[model samples]
Target: MTGYLVRRVGQMGLTLFLIITLTFFLVEAQPGDYASFYVLNPDLPPDVKEKIRAAFGLDKPLWQQYLIHLKNTFTGNFGVSFGHFPRPVMDVLAERIPRTLVLFLTATAASFYLGFFLGKAIAWRRGGLFEYVATISGATLFTAFTPAFALMMIWIFAFRLDWFPLWGNSCIGGLALDILKHMVLPVATLTLISFAGTMLLTRNSMLETIREDYVMAARAKGLPERQVRDRHAARNAMLPVVTSLVYSLIFAIDGSVIIEGVFSWPGTGMTLLSAVRSEDLPLVMGAMLFIGCCRCWLT
Candidate 1:
């Protein structure tokens, strides 16, 4: 286990290096200069550009800039935003990380577990009315187009129609009522969007799993169907699901740009989108790198 963990850590470090290297150079070495991000006044002297360059050490060689970026990154400094923000990159991430995590983790777990248990039920009683009806219903409710519409409809019904709050996290009050209120919409949207895919994946995985020799052998040995499925089938079936889940998670985070924007949630997803629109290169690149690291962690 220790050896395995060490190898995984090494892989994580390698992934980080690749991500940072790509993010740093790709954003820093973009086609146009970072100068346009400043006051683009025609009358502003070129000397001002030189001064700006000198201040940020942009006049240095690209290799030197790379070294500086790497050194600063190691020291927990994400460099000054090419735009006006005074705070470091880490500080911005710290502020927004919780919201993103809460949404993403909540959604992922909701999908994953529901997929697991529910798929088990469907499998245990395949060809029955419940399975047939559920499959049809799941297909509609969890269709790809549904997330945006579902969330919006929910907002309209739950918020505009005098139900739940239209926006924001309600976890602050620590009371069950408040927490449940805040979570209702986002959680429902995420689960609805994710449920079908997860369920389908689980159904397929479990179906294949149960066909394997061991499942038949388990039943032959008088092992209960529950034990056969949960112990012998579920774990083996989940391997592919786990692999699919990693990519789904990455895509989900990326897709959260749309979801978070819609909800006006103060998450890293929203922060990054705003930074990108503002051309805040450092923040944009920092967010990109952060997401890459998250992907690596999932991997």
Candidate 2:
């Protein structure tokens, strides 16, 4: 396992380096560089614009620029952000990363466990009314588009009932409770979206496991239903679910970019979107490369 992990980490690093290189060039290939913004400013003289370009190293060759980016990335300096100019890219990411992780990780965990138990029960009671209702609900949720679902939730909970705040991370100078209150809707939205898939997968896996030879043998020996299901069947069924859960965790780390944007929650997802819109290559490349590396490592 140790050797396997080391090899995977090395592969992940190489993959990340390639991703960084590819994304950098792609962004650079965009119609205009950051200096174009400075060029369009009427107040800045031609000499001042030239100086700005030189200072930003826009005057450097593409190969030289790439080399500088590589060196800075390895050294934990992601360069200055064009979007939040003068603020280092690393610093901007640092603030948003934690917020996104907290929100997404929590939602992922809640969805997984809740779905697991609910699915297990539904599968066990397959022909019952409870199972039918749960299966239908899960199916509905699975088919629902995330953004539309989030909007519907916002309309009902935030606008109509006024149960939760419409957006933002927290109120100014608010306590922990205030932050939790603010997060409820976004977290719920993410959880419900994730839960549907987990529930369906778990139900199918459990159904197959319960019909296996050992489960029948256990039942033949008159073992308790719960033990036969939990110890014998569910354990074996978990292999696929475990695999799915790992990928879900990785996605949680990268975050739900559109969901965060809709909720007005400050997170890496929103920051990355902002960076891309403003053509902040360093920040955009850094964020995308980081997420890609994380996904590679997890896989």
Candidate 3:
């Protein structure tokens, strides 16, 4: 297991390097530099633009910049954010990442386990009305567009009913209850979508497991129906569901930009969106690379 883990870590490092290199060049190739965005003032002198470029090392050759970026990345410095002036990219992420993690982990954990057990229960009673209704609901949710669904939720819960706060992460140093109140809409949006996928996969896996000879033999032994279902069928069916749960948790670390945007949740996803809009290449690249690492490591 140690040797396998070593190999996997090595592969993750190599893949991360390629991702950073490719992302850097692709972002560089985009039209207009970050300096241009700041050059909007008609009276801003050409020398001022040069100063801005020089300060951020954009005036250097692309090769030199790439090398410096690579070194800094290795040393845990993600460079300064061009959009936010001199603020370090890592500093910006530090404040936001924890919030994203809290929200994402909470939503994913709740959805994953709930959906898994719900799926198992439904699978055990496959032909009942409850099973049919749940199956249809899960299928519908899986097919729904994430951003649109989030918007619908915001409109209904926040705008129309005003049950939850419309946006933001709540007041700083606020009570835990206040923070949770603010989280409801965004968490619910992610939960429902994630639940659909988990439930369907779990149900399918359970269905397949129950048909296996081992399950029949367990039943023939006169074991209780619950034991046959839980110990024999559900145990084997959990393999695939667990895999899905892990991937979902890892990717959820990236957060949902659209949902965050709609709800104005100040998390990493919202930060990434702002960085992209302002053409902050360093910040954008940093955020993307971090998210990519999370995904690659888990997969």
Give the whole-model CA lDDT for all candidates, comma-separated: 0.77, 0.81, 0.83
TM-score of 2: 0.88
| CA error at residue 63 for candidate 1, angstroms | 3.4
The Cα error of candidate 1 at residue 153, in Å, is 3.2
Model 1: residue 159 alpha-carbon error in angstroms: 5.3
lDDT of candidate 3 over 212-253, digit per residue (tens): 999999999999999999899999999989888888987576
Give one digit per residue, the lDDT tens place, for model 2 in 1-299.
Answer: 99998998898788888888888888898888867755777988889998988988889999999898788778898777876656887887777778777888888888898788888888888989998888788778767888899899999999999998887756434688887887899888878777867887888999999989999999999999999888998889888887899888886766567878788787777777777888777788778877777677787
Stretches of model 3 off by over 4 angstroms after superposition? 1-6, 34-45, 84-86, 211-224
State TM-scores per candidate: 0.77, 0.88, 0.87
- Residue 284's lDDT in candidate 1: 84
Candidate 1 Cα deviation (angstroms), residue 196: 2.3
Q: State, as a TM-score between 0 and 1, how close model 1 is to the true structure.
A: 0.77
Candidate 2, residue 227: Cα displacement in angstroms equals 4.4
Model 1 bad stretches (over 4 Å): 1-11, 29-45, 82-85, 141-143, 169-180, 208-248
lDDT winner: 3
lDDT ranking from best candidate downward: 3, 2, 1
lDDT: which is higher, 1 or 2? 2
